[model samples]
Target: MNPPAEPPSRAALQAAASQRLHPLSWLFLLLAQLRAFALPLLVLLFGGGRREDGIADLIGLLAAGLLALTAVWRYFTYHYGFLGQALVIRSGLLQRNLRLVPFDRVQNVTVHQNLLHRLFGVASVRLESAGGLGQAEAQMDVLRLDQARALEALVRQGAQRARAAAAASGEGPEAATPAEPAPVLWLHLPMRELVRLGLISNRGMLVVAALFAALSQAGDAVMKPLGNQLYAGLKEGESWAASLHLGPLAYGLASLLLLLGLLALVRALSVALAIVQFHDFRLLAGERELSVERGLLSRVRAHLPKRRVQAYTLHESLLHRWFGRRSLSVDRAALETGNEAAALRELVPLATPEAMDGMLQRLLPEGSWPPRHWQPLHPRAWRRVAFPGLLATLAASGLLVAWKGLPGLWLLLLLPLVVLRARIWARYSAWSLEGGVISVRQGWLDRHWRFAEVRKLHALELRQSPFDRRHGMASLHLDSLGAHPMAPPLRIPYLPVAEAVRLAAALRAGMPRDAGVSRARTAA
Candidate 1:
């Protein structure tokens, strides 16, 4: 009998399966390069005024040609394939770099398809790992949409297998068995909720502010003329109103109406923006992963391994309260350095409090929201919170007395408001440590709740200011991987020094032994 054919070698299998990006990847790559250099090219083309140099035009053409050539070269050189449980990528034309990323290490896989990509039936794929240091570990600029989905599935299966193997070896948590249930549709935002989300967000104001800043920086030639026109128009309007002999009350009523109209416009813009950004939003919870798909013009599908979640935050703004909605977001350990628009940040953009509770229960069965008991801050914490405002008010009153005499003392009326704010904050601000999780609640007008599993804690800090020392108080701050930079910090301030130390010790002890939670003691 002929000898049994030997199993194919790993190298042979990998070489056989290695694949290049879509044939049109070069075009997409060229477009990306041009987009990056668009501003400079526009300046080079237009900054020359009416007198354009042939040399400059020729140089621009050469640069475009070079970019196209580079894109083509890169498309031909880059190759990716699966080698056992790892994804292997070979890239770089000159240096010839090889990178191997184990499936178990991938924290997130994102597939993005903008309007152009959708038209071409292609998408960009990004793999983010914890060790990427705020960068994507692997990125494929353009791939057939079907191929991208296939790759995502391969990674998911490979990661599941890795987890099973690790569990069998007693090195990781228990893996999901075949009996695990199907993925649950946790949340789906319809047009109504999307509208509510838009109404709750202040994105229109942010957009207007950004536009104003950009206009202000458009050089004196542009902004000076624009500002003069605006001023002259305002003067003309004022003269017109004066000619109408409108009383102060009528003028006030007109101003209020104008303000209301402007606010209505802003809200309309926000609603439109929200609809565009989060159209067809869906969140699905699988056995060990959470998947979110959203966007209208730029469709995005992102997968987050449930194990990588570091913390959770709930936001309730005044508008959200008015709409009976709250937003929930989670911080993941994945270090993502790609387009923020495509990031999987907001888990639930708008949900009723009851709906949010259900989500929290499903997401964290072992943990609870609005913990049974919250440890109140030191009773005198309000005094500390209000001291600065009180001092500022008194100083301003003094300054006013020095300048405008008795009229300056009118500012002293702000003191009551400042102290009332502090009292309200003290009443609401509290922390809770229970069931291996730490939760903090703060704010009066715009309430926020931040919580995280103890095992995910990265660092603990105890800070004491001179005033704190005098009052025998301390502040405990918690740090976790992938905490949102813009989110309110997970800090518990104005705790008795002894209680703070005890809580810190408890947190440190609860942290996983292998996590190596760091502790810092500082005086502020």
Candidate 2:
């Protein structure tokens, strides 16, 4: 029997000729182009057009043919290869383009395989660097799965070598030890946990709202019919209820029950969606990188270098508290764009508080967790928070009184609730600076804890509002690379101006020399 063949060495692979994309790349590219123009094409085909002459149909066919030809041209022109420690890519037909990306600058490598790609034994590979803003530095539409994996491995190896060389030159040979090969399993979310996560999240409501907005944008032609059908259903429901001749209390109870039933249905849909999206979710940690694998219909495999993580966030919503769960996410140096944005955010989507603490300890051994003492904000911070609520309440009450006279007086009852909320927020919100890590906590009901190593922070801002200046208090904002725009900011609000200034100086002093910390003062 013939012996099994050994895998090729790095030197051998690098010496090999430049590689082109898989033969089926054109098909995938065509499909992508069609998806991008799907809305316009649908309008051209079905909307009022030259149907008798079939001119619109002819135009669509011609457009599709042109797209197919372009895809083929792109496939034939694009070529990629390795040159020393950099990956070289050459493309473009009319105006040739060449790009060389050094492995050390690559922060994340993602491999995606939808159902179609999996069926065809192919995968889409994306390389994300720190300088691409929110876009991937390079994307390979479709490649053989084995070849893609090989390319990822090569990049990882090259990056490791670069890091080792830098460490040896800067910190001596002891700091340049090779990374461990064994991978540690960090988390494996079961179906039950996914269901819990879905229950805790408002994804279902967001999806419903998005659908409603889309329907509203479909113009009266589509929404008018839907509105009519809904109105007719409501009329039928009212008639049926009247036929029952139910008492007022009974009617109220029935309506409440119906509302609850609808909520239950929405929650069920959310559970199913979560299960489909995160089935068989697993997070693994190697010495130098973290690996995430998840999804049911469209599998995704992503790799993030450990050093690329810039900041960490812990979230605990009211629903999460009820379920005894919390979530953990990270801001990495690479900003993933498009469908890949959701790839590596949820390092721990849902877990017990104790479990999350343990995971954090294992993942970030350099930093401390659960600070022993939290530094409180200014003594009058509660008043600062409550003032806005009080003003808003007064304004709303005045408007309601103008609209409905004495009946609107009841709105003033919300004033106390607003004050209570502000008090809670002021009491819970705090900051901690310990062991080269800076942590900030905020929120009353849905709490967020954002933290980062001092060295990772790139900028700091101190701002003073007119009210803040009058009260001798200010706010501090800490900026890190690749932070999610929608996530709660890492800001410490309502701090004494002197304290804020001292804190900013201390943080800047702790930052690494090469980090180039920038400070700014702004008035708002």
Candidate 3:
């Protein structure tokens, strides 16, 4: 065998003096400081009836002013500074804190920008480290957007150099294959497809956003009426605006309705905004890295190494089905924290399953990709699906009949049929594991066929409750490296024991044999 070469020395970069906070941000901070100082003093003065008291007012103002000044001073002195090898942040007042994050230890880096950030030409950079607790685990806050990109480029260069140096020193054996030249792949969803995806997701995020906006407006309306009524004698009588505000219960309902309409309008606005944000969105494929840059006012940039990807997934929502569009996800095992949850590295409508497969094959190491031919669930799986639903319905019906009387009995008749249909639907949705990938087909209303790379699975579980064992069936749960605190592992019930073992073996084979890698390959 050829002798491994020594790794190269890593490079380092440094940031300039801390930039001043945005003018708006500075104003907001001042106002917040003032409020914090004044609120307590006002409360104390009113509660103690000490306004007429000697020197109290003067003392309070002095204290408040001093506190605000201190805060401003702290802000300026403890700003963020970047070094090529590590991120440096200094914070605190009396007891200061200085943190240095090495580039090699960094699991991931993300750049986030909002409308304000875009307008101000600033960005927030979040750095995730595997070693830390609670808030200390992830470092984040705003930075100048241009400066952020520069820092990221520095980090990337440093990391590459470190890897090369490690290889040169024979400290890293995997240096057989140097990082590939960054591949250039562009991805997008057409307007029609985008619309379809937006609708199908029924994700309700847009709706929820609209609802919140409407509710806030309604609350403002309600409060305005009350305020008008309370100050009526002091000023003029209530006007139309006041009557339409918070006064009576009837007015509240009207306000709610009006708010609802406003919310609907907001939802539409949000959807329109989303379309604009993601419009002409593109993900460029780099040799060893993936770069995601999207949105209008808020531009986001994420850098991911293909080698670090533990898994890949393709998902389709109802709208995705109608428009034949799919969302592609790549999971980086090293950064299996909340930061990685929202499908870290998402690509919208890259291509079809076959096309995605081709992409995966190109991106992944040879022999690690999953087989495409997945076996669907046995036809008998339908019985398992239907029987439980039926039983639950019957039990519910029996209780209703016993407690509420005859009308409940009618529910009993529909229960069995509903369950049976549900079972058939479940059965129709089939899945199989090929190579290092697991494919699942599921749906009753809007069907989806999802594919996940086996290596991405954080854990593989073979479970058989008493009932399952009796039926000679088992369940396989596959957990991905996502950041969701409550993300449930994907479960494929009604699988045979032998089949589950085979799947486990594949996952183990695909996982990298590195101590630095998480122990996700093991089967349980």
Best by TM-score: 1
Q: After superposition, how far is residue 517 of candidate 3 from its true place, in Å?
A: 17
Q: Please report the TM-score between candidate 3 and the true structure.
A: 0.69
- RMSD after Cα superposition, model 2: 5.4
lDDT of each: 0.85, 0.85, 0.59
User: Candidate 2: where is the Cα deviation over 4 Å?
Assistant: 1-17, 165-179, 365-367, 512-524
**How far is 339's C-alpha from truth in model 2 (Å)?**
3.2
Candidate 3 local lDDT, 357-416, one digit each (tens)? 566677655653444455666446677777777788889888998999988888778866
Per-residue lDDT over 49-137 for candidate 2, one digit per residue giving the tens place of the 0 to 100 score: 45698999988899999999999999998888887677877788799777777788888888899999989999999998767777777
Candidate 1 Cα lDDT to native: 0.85
User: Which structure is stronger by TM-score: 1 or 3?
Assistant: 1
Displacement of the residue 430 alpha carbon in candidate 1, Å: 1.3
Question: What's each prediction's TM-score?
Answer: 0.92, 0.90, 0.69
| Candidate 1 ranges with C-alpha deviation above 4 Å | 1-14, 48-52, 169-173, 176-181, 339-342, 365-367, 514-524
**What is the per-residue lDDT of model 1 for residues 206-264, given as tens digits with 9 covering 90 to 100?**
88999999898778868988989999999999999989999989999999999999999
**Lowest lDDT block of 10, candidate 2:** 8-17
